[model samples]
Target: MPQSSNVPNGASAAPKAKYNRPKPVVLAVIDGWGVAPHWGGNAVTLAKIPFMNKAMQEFPHTTLQASGEGVGLPPNERGNSEVGHLNIGAGQVVLQYFPSITKAIQDKTFFSNEVILQGINQAKQNGKRVHIIGLVSPGGIHSHIEHLYALLEVAKQQQFTDVCIHAITDGRDTPPFVSQEFLADVTTKTQELGVGSICTVSGRYYSMDRDHRWERVEKSYRAMVEGVGPTAATPEAAVAAAYRDGFSDEFIPPTVIQGPKNTFKPIMDGDTVIFFNFRGDRAREITQALMKPNFEGFDRKKSVSNLYFVGFTYYEEGLPIHVAFRPHNVKKSLSGVISDAGMRQLHVAESEKYAHVTYFFNGGNEQPVKGEDRIVIPSPHVPSFDQVPEMSTVQIADTVIQNINRYDFIVLNFACPDMVGHTGNLRAAIQSCEAVDANLNKIAQAVAQAGGIFAITADHGNVEQMVNPKTGEPDTEHTNNPVPFIVTGNAVVNCQLRSGGILSDVAPTLLHILNIPKPAEMTGSSLLVVQPQVARSAASTL
Candidate 1:
């Protein structure tokens, strides 16, 4: 969905005299928090978040449609940390990479990609097998079934004798108990191709831990290398057992696929592994395991020796030698413009979502800006986030308060609600909401003490809508509910924000607060406009 467009310099535009009030702005992004009607399934409404609730009533606030085309994603796509932060930092409706990747596969351009071809040909020349691995779902957030099917077709046409697929099932992105539907489609396609095979299967949570939760990574490592995990006669049986045991597809135990001849194929030396996930965070740890010779993050008891590993995109641009496709690379971001305009920026988040605040936020740039300060508090190294639902919330607030006076622009990400929300634990999720509220109070107070403006917004929605209305059960996936954007400071007094705002509107509003001109490339307009006639008349009468 990315288009070729010219970048504009904000310096050339005339600044609005009435809006010219510069102030240091503290932008707080509450991850996976949303505004919704208080209902049975709405955890945010049920939780005690008095500070946030008061802010909504007393401060200037507006609603933001964080998901779908509001943030420049394909319609109906629920917002994730990646797209949400990226749109916020870019200050515009930048196209996402999902549709482009899907288009490339449909057009058969994926097979012709230079890096992809290089990896495949290298394996063929070395007389080795090509192993394709990714999340096996139709979810457009990470990997999709259509993309996987395209890869299978390409491999068959290339006539590669030995091709294996290692799948990571999902219920977090898709609905629970639907792994069999995806597996059935995969099996039918493989049968039609008359080539390739499914090697191993497991849940994404174990294999895709973004933070250095080595314990979870180790379990997946053992499953792939030592073939040491629960097993079933078939993928259908494994999925059925997972549901019977009260687990979703993403939480299912690893299962090695039994071939038609009852042979289990574990990845060994002289194999090329292509990770098909376009999103970076979840794919980073697993990709590193395969690429690094002496990775100590987790123990790979059996060596996965002499492997050619390739990711759909280089997750970390700092380490750029291990990817098959280049990212869309959003240009002229708000961060870059702020840096260019002589403003010092500070980014803070836990390791679980550090990249989202810095990397994805700044058009996928992994390097720290020369004049910027970045702080990454370590996330709890636990198997499940619900165990300590208040993960790093207090520590993050303390860090922000300590450094509140150091920068012109400060961005903070509270990751607790989103992380715990994914676990579908109502109690833990409520605790997470309270923790976030308390920390927000601390941070907002600190910002006020520093005589700075603080704006509160969220990347997406998760805990706000925790239960499925249809089933009346805990729902782990993100919701399409709009989030709240509240701004408080002397600079924003009597500021009128237009309705129908989205995530992209935040950056422009922040720029307006700082008395900076918005760039022409930014499609989103500033919400701070002229006062309404009714409010003006009331003020005059008073």
Candidate 2:
């Protein structure tokens, strides 16, 4: 296993000369908050959000390009949590997984990749079934269906007879009613090839979990192991039932489809499971469920013995795994710079997005920094986030208040708007915005009480533009819109952001506020109105 440290080479990872710690900096990333015209369809504009509104009117604020090529996505592509958070934390534009994976597939490199071939060869040697599992969506958030197609094609070429697919349904990023269609297409494709079968099906909400949500994982385990939850005569019936029950296609509970000869096919021992999702956040826990023996996070009832598991890529460099593709190596993130500058950092976020503030924000490294304080608040456990739009906002605010003065730098992620936005509930989305507003008031005051600076921004746009212009109905997908970037409070730096700033610029700006030089590899420039003392003093007389 390769070891990674936040402290760059030739630089001290801790404080050498306590160079007058500046005022505490409170940086908040309000998930899904965006800038849109004040209209009925705009949730943020329609909601009664006093704090964010006041910041727009009084604080040093500007528009940041959060989606598309602005954040290293393909032209006109919407930004997702994985790329958005990675870019924000890296202080540079990290190429997104979708485009990179697409390129590899187009170039035929992924099909013959050593890691994937190794998995197939090992399966053949051990006389085991090679089972592929991941999110079944083209939304480009988790795993895309195209990746599945490539894997199935490879399986056919290799003449693998014992192949299965466990699809994690998705409706959050795409339309809310397309899981059945997706499954049908995959089932038909696999049948035509005569290589793989759709063995198990469930929603990503239950299987793709972070923050130690064991119950959700157990639900997935039951669906695969015991045919628990809803049962359908066929995949088509299950999709219809999911819609009839008023649940989104993505949030559909675990359902099992009857296999040939009218039998329930469950995942058993000697099965090699490969998670095809390139992004790591949600894939981590479920992958562990299959890979780790004596896994205490959740009880799988029976021991899933002698199972060979692999991820599309080993997400965290610290944890080694046999994977198919090469995961992007994100280095020299803001966390490393902060650690090298010898700043005490606190990362606070609810379970829904805790990894974004800690793991992703630290350049995809899972291990904690030498002097980092991390707090994860559990989100509400419900079928849907709209059930509780005000999800953990108060708890997050309370955490900030309690630890405001303990750390020099506090990074927080509020996950209401984004999580609820995916539910396509206009009322709930508005309420989520209002909830974020109320908590922002509490948090900003806490930052002021601690004599710190408060900087607020968003990963991407979701609740901002609620309605689709064409259909005039609630649009659940994230919008390709600019987000607000505001800086306020006593510790505010005398700085103005350059024109056309993007998410990557945030890390550099935050480091500048703390009197740290940007790493050489960081492509974004600091958006501060003035440069640091070393340069400011030189220019004083010039």
Candidate 3:
């Protein structure tokens, strides 16, 4: 029935267009919601986050471990941004800092056989800047203040020329606004030894109410001065409010974003940067800003180049450390953690085991979030008693939204639940969780609009319960708890799934979703509804 002219030329064929299925990708990460059982931080409590609730109940959700046998920091480390992100990114679990170093410093294992300490001593002998950039805390969580203190003492005894401590801020371990105290103590000890000008740089903190006074930022005074709320009804009140409150955004004098541009100048080259976070996350953000510019936040004369490096304090060394110590079990290795380094002087109490695995990376370049990838954290993260809790809220969002078109893999980490958990302020924690819930909805909507898949999983637990303080109330410590993770979107449809998961499996599952190559390094598995061809039976088996 074809026309004669059309049918003639030896049966012409139609051209076939090349068709390729979209490459699969998996983006898995633990937000602050997953607090260790007994401690604090509840992603769930920050806001009435409808999206998280939906993901938990509607999709392939599961509760994975953050620290303690899961992501592996110490049983006592607690889930943190650094440790969790590293584990998910690399898809593997490894040791961050062995108690071995702490042990040797304590004389539990003498300096005779310790490689790291010996190396430091050797560096000191070279007349190099034997710097120790460590945490000024006693909890033995990140960089132990006492460890640096004792280490500095040793360096002085060995006649090191220049000894410095790039003391960064700390709020997760000790009370907020206590850096000055720690700095004072360090100054006294350094002066006593006359050890290379142990100067205490006023490292910026997330909560700096007043230069170093440990109360909520002077908000009411600012309100009065700026005519904010009822506090500023009259000129007299405003005049009385001149003592600026740095915490609240009422009416204080303007301040610059804390960094080298601030009172502290940018670090110079060959400065021997030493990261001291036993857990990670916080350290990595600054490291990246200092070193590279994934998002636009970095501001320096030149990008971070030039220097010897040490420690898992940043994200570039992407991966999580296994915290193998048993909970409630005394690690037989170290004799007395506190006594070995005089941590009490630094106002910290050291311990071997706890839950809380924080992620730390060399944040010069963050994991880019893009098409098919989503970040699920609490929306509009509410400020705590002071300012916002963790920089993760701003930092993570910037990284995800900025380079969101490059890769299909992504990460979503909601921090409200964890931040609120620490305050033990029940109402605040709940509000924070709700905020995260709302934000999750936004992320899901974005993914759905893009026709992408999104999953929600936590590295540990926090929001479900609250812990009391150590001295005053039954709070302050953490409880052994379980968290949840969920998955959804058009991609993961109609497949049998179970909820069993560990923090190690969070990132690997994403590879399954994207149908991409899985890094053998990961400890987690794909929680997709259907297994890949590799995971399924071969033709002969079928």
TM-score of candidate 3 versus the correct structure, residues matched by position: 0.54
TM-score of each: 0.90, 0.90, 0.54
Counting clashing residue pairs in each candidate, in order, gives 0, 2, 97
Taking the tens digit of each residue's C-alpha lDDT, what string does model 1 give over 1-542?
A: 11111112211222123332334588989999988899877879899989988887777888899999888677888998998999888888777777778778778788787777776778889888888888999877787878788788777777774777778898887776689889878877888987677777888988888877777777777777777887877777778888899878888887877746335667778778888888888988877776677688866777777777778876764443467777766677778767766776778888888888888888788765545667788888776789998999898888778767766778889999898888888889999999999999998888887777889999999898788889887788888889889987655656666789988888898886776778887777787664666345423321
How far residue 472's Cα lies from its native spot in candidate 3, in Å, is: 6.4
Q: After TM-score superposition, what is the CA distance of residue 417 in candidate 1 from its true location, in Å?
A: 1.6
Model 3 residue 68 CA deviation (Å) reads 2.8
Candidate 1, superposed: residue stretches over 4 Å from native: 1-23, 243-246, 259-262, 318-322, 532-542
Worst 10 residues of 1 by lDDT: 1-10
- Candidate 3 lDDT over 152-172, as tens digits, reads 566566666365554444444
Candidate 2 Cα deviation (angstroms), residue 300: 2.5
- Candidate 2, 170: how far from true, in Å? 0.9
* Candidate 2 segments whose C-alpha is farther than 4 A from its true place: 1-21, 227-230, 259-264, 315-321, 490-495, 531-542
